[model samples]
Target chain A: MLAIETKQLSKSFWKNKVVDNIDLQVEKGEILGFLGRNGAGKSTFINMLTGIIQPSSGSYALLGVQGPNDSIKKKIGVMPDYSSLYGSMTAINHLHYLADVSGKPVSRQHCMEVLKLVGLEEHANKKAGKFSFGMKKKLAIAQAIIHDPQLIFLDEPTSGLDAESVIHIHLLIQQLHQQGKTIFMTSHNLDEVEKICSRIAIMKDGRIKKSGTMDELRAYYQSTITVTIKHSPIRPADLSTMQQWLEQAGTQLDIKENHFTIQVESEQKIAEIIRALGTYKIDIYRVDVEEPSLEEIFLEE
Target chain B: MLAICKREFIQSFKGIKSIIIIAIFLLTAYYSADFSDLLLSLSDDFTSEEKQIIHTVGISFLIMFLGMLFVMGLSHDIVNREMHERTIRFLVTRTSRTSIIVGKFLGIALFWFVCLLTSFVIISIFVHRFDLITLFQSASLAIYYSAFTVLLSVLIPKPSITMFLSIVIGIAFPILNGWVSLTSNVWVSWLKYLFPFYYVEEQNYSFLVVLLLAGVMVGIALLVFRRREC
Candidate 1:
């Protein structure tokens, strides 16, 4: 079963559409990274799927359950913002409370185990209000996964976090994913998502403009690859010769004295260009090929 | 639902809200036992038997009118405060919105029940009588006001606005209801029925009707809260 499926999902406030016609699908165990610029309706869309707000129109289903209820909610966990925690409640108390609220009363040992996974076991007795920002975030994560849900929606799971907290959360997420839990995450940290997620979706102005694997999105955006060459300084004569040979390739070569950057359509083209350059007898130090990154894909116009 | 109810019930006493309510109820019960003698000597509105009713459980009657105002103070922010703080999102995701409304209402009602039972027990010990009728009356009035405040909080999800209005309704409703009940003019007399004192003032067990009013308010609160954007 798909973890989540939405059809023409939209929400409006005073007729101002925020999440507009967002049709999204997530397969059962793959992490789908949701990326967007600010005000891209990412949070609003997640809110609708989590049942925090009813969609102004359209429909959605989670884990084969249509619409939201205790059953769907019991299976899906939403990582809430740190501000949503009650100040007076301790970390352990929050876990027990949220677990019971979901109609799954976990054992004390289980609650502590989740807390330990989030690196908050020592602070279990501390009030949430007394926690630092990073600690509060971990607490939020602990609460979200207290019931060991099948699907987890982590909205900005590591934003505003310290480096260590970010890594901890990422590892926890990876651990969850390894355990066959499907994760839908939104983050400003593109590198983290690129490193962790198996699939990605980019949203803008309430619409998803792109959705695919890294290679798939890169192919959709641009097939060009960057090849960096550490070669001996090129004479103006060699530069002209290279440009003329590349004219038929429909691209230009960038030469910065000893090093140069070239865009090629395919690995075959790179190999052809390498042989062409070697024929000139120029001493090439090394070559590095770089694929398009998630950042570049997200910034695609 | 029961989990949410239990949390709210325990959390209610974690702050000064429940403490203030309990102290007020207990202090009034302590003073009403003595002050009834002084008031009974000066009052002419009641028969000798009517004076006896006041003497035994005047604290319940007093709370029936004014305790609701205190209840407004206690639960006026229960629903909207969560929305204002963005905590309702955490709740609605875990449980149904109806569970939030009904659970919180049940929690606050439990507090009132405990407070009233303790105070009435004190009154009964002092006067050597347990007024089950007046206890129910006081409880019904509390339920009416608590449910109304929860409904109001859901209607106006802004805490600052509801806090202002709760105090206004708390003070104004009782005074207006009391005045309207005293005035026999047919046109304005119906206005007294709009408040709790009208039912409370009647000897025909009308306070039980306040429970019906509370139930309706809770039903409406559930509907309003279910559609609200968390």
Candidate 2:
């Protein structure tokens, strides 16, 4: 079953629409990264899905449940876009209370295990009021998954964190994914999303502008493929043959010392040039195909 | 619902509000019992049941005069505080909004029950007998205030605004109630019907109306809270 589905979902404040008419779906056991700039309606969309706020129009379903009823709530977890922790509560107490309230009470030992999963085992007894920003973020994640929810919504899980904390969070997310849990996360860090998300959706001005796998996006926006080849020095006869083949593709190769960088229309032309070079009896050292980064695709629009 | 209720109830006792409210309640119970005792000493024909009734009425008078104010003061920000802190966002996703309102009401009502029971224990120390029905009435009166506090917290969108209105109503309600009996105007006298003094007589049935009012307020609060955006 689909983990999350929305059809023509929209939310408007007064005259301004925050989440425009949008259709989106996330499959079970997939980590879908929601990407957008600031004020891009990412959080608002999540708020509607999690029942924090009702949608202005349209409808949604979570795990085959049409509404945010008890079954749906018990099946999913969320870390909201704001500070959702109680200041006076300890990390363990927060988990314990939330678990009980969700009607899926876990053991204290299990709560400790969840704390350990997020690298917060040492601070289990520490009050959340005294935690650092990174620690608070970790605690927030722990609470979201404490009930063993099948679908988890993490809003900016690692927006502001040290490199170490970011890595820790990334690993925890991956671990959760490994357990067959569907994760829907929103992040401003494009590189992190690129590194972690199995699928991605980009939002802009309250609408989804682009969404696909990295390779799919790269292939769509990538107009020219740049190939770098390191080979033996070439003779004039071999050079002319290479030049003729490169010119046929409307681009020429850049030769510096022992390496050549050439732009071609597709991967087929790269294979043709490699075969041509081999026919000339040149020792081919290496060939590299540069795929566009998520940053590049995100900024292209 | 029970889980949220348990948390709220436990949290109430963690700070000084419980201690302070209980201490003052014990003192009030002591004074009320002492005054009733002095009156009893002046008379010899009154039966034991009559003595218990007098002592209960004396204690109930002070409790009724201050119960609404105490509950409103303690619980004025109950819902709005969660909204202000954004913790309600976490709760809304885990449970239904109706349960949150009802859970909070149960918590506050339970706290009031404990406070009333303690004061009754103090009053019993002097009278040599416990008044179970009076404790029930005082506890129900406090629960009535608790219901209104929940409604106010849900109706006002901001914590500051709710707190302000709770204080205004808490102070004003008792004062107006004091004048409700003395005034000759029909409009002013109508409010006495809302007062516990108008209902808590041995044979009066109007006390049930207070409970019915509490039920209606809670029902309205549940409806309002469900539509609120966390």
TM-score of 1: 0.93
Off by over 4 Å in 1: A230-241, A256-259, A278-285, B34-52, B184-187
For candidate 2, give the lDDT.
Answer: 0.85
Listing candidates in order, what is each one's chain A TM-score? Answer: 0.93, 0.88
Per-model TM-score of chain B: 0.89, 0.86
TM-score, candidate 2, first chain: 0.88
Please give the lDDT score at residue A166 for candidate 2. 94
RMSD of each: 2.5, 3.3
lDDT of 1 at A270: 76
For candidate 2, the docking band is medium
Clash pairs, model 1 backbone: none
The numbered model that scores best in TM-score is: 1
Candidate number of the best DockQ: 2
